[model samples]
Target: MFGIFIQHHVSKPNPPKKLLCNEGNLLSQIDGKGTVYTRVGGLSCNYDKGTLIISDKSNRVALNIE
Candidate 1:
């Protein structure tokens, strides 16, 4: 009698890349109710009511959802 054996390997998926909103290309989120937005790499923003404002030292953007 004889038998055969096989081996398999699996790899983990890469994490998502952090995004930034800039001039000529702004990142906007619609219907962002109850959603938490976080900025990676020391980026920060402010949110109030139905508006989201993300700004840096030189640029600023405001997104309002109705």
Candidate 2:
């Protein structure tokens, strides 16, 4: 799956960040953890304590926003 994270700064606008994941099923959770599917594959994601985690079978990515 492909994920896009867009951050908008108060000073200006910037380009969005894109992430790609593979090999997972699409699922959604009410507790801030879920799997999203896109045209490419599936990605598992978690958001907790101002940090966001995105992963697949082969890769894991984390982003922190304040």
Candidate 3:
């Protein structure tokens, strides 16, 4: 009854509210606060290694650069 009504009204997924750029640069919102960020170098993430590493302009592993 009610389930059938919901099924018929299903809608497409909403578009992502975040934006991303090459080399691991991204802009997103947290707690309804908006933010934007940009990086000067490359970045990488290895799920198996359980790490998300980012680099600075000199390609150094700098997690505290900000």
* Best candidate according to TM-score: 2
Ranking by lDDT: 2, 1, 3
Q: Write the per-residue lDDT of candidate 2 for residues 1-66, one digit (tens) a residue.
A: 122322333335433333332233323322223543233236676665876677788998787854
TM-score sort, best first: 2, 1, 3
Model 2 segments beyond 4 Å from truth? 1-40
Worst 10 residues of 3 by lDDT: 39-48
Give a tens-digit lDDT track for model 1, residues 1-66.
Answer: 122222222233334333334432334332335643333433456665766666667787786743
Taken over the whole model, the C-alpha lDDT of each candidate is 0.46, 0.49, 0.41
Which lDDT value does model 3 have at 19? 33
Model 1 global lDDT (CA atoms, 0 to 1): 0.46
Q: Roughly what TM-score does model 3 have, to 2 decimal places?
A: 0.25
Candidate 3, residue 28: Cα displacement in angstroms equals 5.3
Which has the better lDDT: candidate 1, or candidate 3? 1
The weakest ten consecutive residues by lDDT in model 1 span 1-10
Model 3: CA > 4 A from native: 1-23, 26-29, 33-48, 62-66
Q: Report clash pairs, candidate 1.
A: none
